[model samples]
Target: MTISKHIYFAAPMFANSDLRYNAYLVKKIRQLNHQVTVYLPQENGDINEKSAYADSKMIAQADADEVLKSDLLIAILDGLVIDPGVASEIGIAFAKEIPVIGLYSDTRQQGADNQKKLAALQETAENQFHYLNLFTAGLVKLNGQITNNEEDFLHGIQKFLETGEINDLS
Candidate 1:
């Protein structure tokens, strides 16, 4: 029998788009491994219901509790910048020695070999790429990895479940 594992999914859950995307990805991850239980914060209506009145301490303590219990954390790294809440979860997971898998699906990260895109980097503020905070990303890399797409992210989870190790997917 497969051993059951718990996962903490950290992402921005304020907007409708973010909510839909988080649910979709969590569903896909569940389909990939039935033995895994993903703790998606948006599902916790007690503290996550925007219509309700949950104070800052309530939200932080609730989410941090789940993060501490997770075997792994899958953080969504797609935004104008890494969501502050997600960054905090990454830090918590790192401090507790839980591995993290960051999904960075920004399209701006493409065109690695395009000469024009590379040349644009010479101009100030003309960089053709999205930047992720290195410190938060470093915390993830110290224990796990950051995947560019969903396919690789799922693969990383599978590998970690089977062997408790993250391979360099670059």
Candidate 2:
């Protein structure tokens, strides 16, 4: 069995719908196993009653600090494009050598031309097309996994927690 560890959950928290999804993901992650605690910036940030600018800076810094101290980071990469803030968090996790797991389920076709689609832009080590930037995908591939659904996400987390490693899912 894997020991308990802290995981930073990074996602776009600016929208109401996104916030709700973040909450749901947190709940599901908590239930995935008894050995992991989730640090969700949307819920843990010291943003209450603060000015917009102050709150934004404080929240961003707090999240970054948590990511640095965390054992792992799970990023939500759903949407037309990866959320800029979440992408930054993923980069930080990579730089810190913390394991990362990316969950992206948006299946909408991204571009009008096949050449412009992310999948067509880069092929994985396994020769499969991944619908994400090569650099971003490569970072996560180093120490963690990228999944698109709840089942795969749970499996990825469990696998990472057990072995401290995961495979490239691209």
Candidate 3:
């Protein structure tokens, strides 16, 4: 029997491609019968408002509410640098002790367009010995897993469902 889990899907939704990619992931997970109830912020948040501050606050609250209710967070950490909002969401999940699974599907070797930015990120990764931020990586290490491809994400999800635990940080 498969256990049903609620996953807070955190990803970059700044581009049309990103939204489509998120939909693909959601569909694939459902097709695989992982029994996950995904909470996607991009789909749930209220973006259009007269006041910029109000809009931002509303969106933040919506996302935070979902994060608070989720059993775990499935974060797409694909960009050269982690998205600031996603980073903040990760922090919330971490503080709440919710599990986090980081999915780094981008295979490109170039860390950033700028040489200096790339060097800085490389140094940060090397210094902390993590592919991303030390704090974020530590949170994932403590609770869930990290995967780098679609196959791995699927397998990781299955594994997590079965064991209620994950260790795929490889």
Candidate 4:
């Protein structure tokens, strides 16, 4: 018998791209394992609906409760910076010792071995890669890992489910 797992998906939900990407990844994760239940915050209309009036405390408490209950957290680290809400969720998970899997799919992160890219990093204002807050990223690494793409993210979840541990897949 498969043991059930709860995953809290923390991501930016304001843009069409963010919404669609979150849905797609959540679907893929669900398909990956029948016993997994993903709690996507945007789907919680009570606190997330723009037309509704959920106070800041209400939203924080709600999401924090879910984070505490989750077996794992999948944080999308693809925006200009890690979304503030997502960062808070990460902190909560870190404090509670819940494992977190971060997905950072920025295109600029590609071509790691390219000489030109390496050279550009040395030039002032010529950095080609995006920066992620190291403290937040470190929190994830302490309990889990950050995957660069969808496949690795799913793989990380699978590995975590089967072994109760996560690894650096970068």
Clashing pairs in 1: none
Question: TM-score for each prediction?
Answer: 0.95, 0.76, 0.76, 0.94
Ten contiguous residues with the weakest lDDT in model 3: 45-54
Q: Which pairs of residues clash in candidate 4, taking residues 3 or more apart in a chain or in different chains?
A: none
Q: What value does the lDDT take at residue 3 in candidate 2?
A: 73
What is the C-alpha lDDT profile of model 3 across 76-150, one tens digit per residue?
887767878888888898889888888877655445465665556566353322356777767766777778788
Please estimate how well model 3 matches the true structure, expressed as its whole-model Cα lDDT: 0.74
Instruction: List clashing residue pairs in candidate 2.
Output: none
lDDT of prediction 2: 0.77
TM-score of 2: 0.76
- Summarize candidate 2's per-residue lDDT along 54-81 as a digit string, tens digits: 5567767777888999998998878666
Candidate 3 backbone collisions, by pair: none
Q: lDDT by residue for model 1 over 1-170, one digit each (tens)?
A: 34678999999999999999999999988887788999999999999988898999999999999999999899999999999999999999999999899999999999989999999999999999888899999999998899988899988888777666775654
Cα-based RMSD of the predictions, in order?
A: 1.4, 6.0, 5.7, 1.5
Which stretch of 10 consecutive residues in model 1 shows the poorest summed lDDT?
161-170
TM-score of 3: 0.76
lDDT of 2 at 110: 34
Q: Which of candidates 1 and 4 reaches a greater TM-score?
A: 1
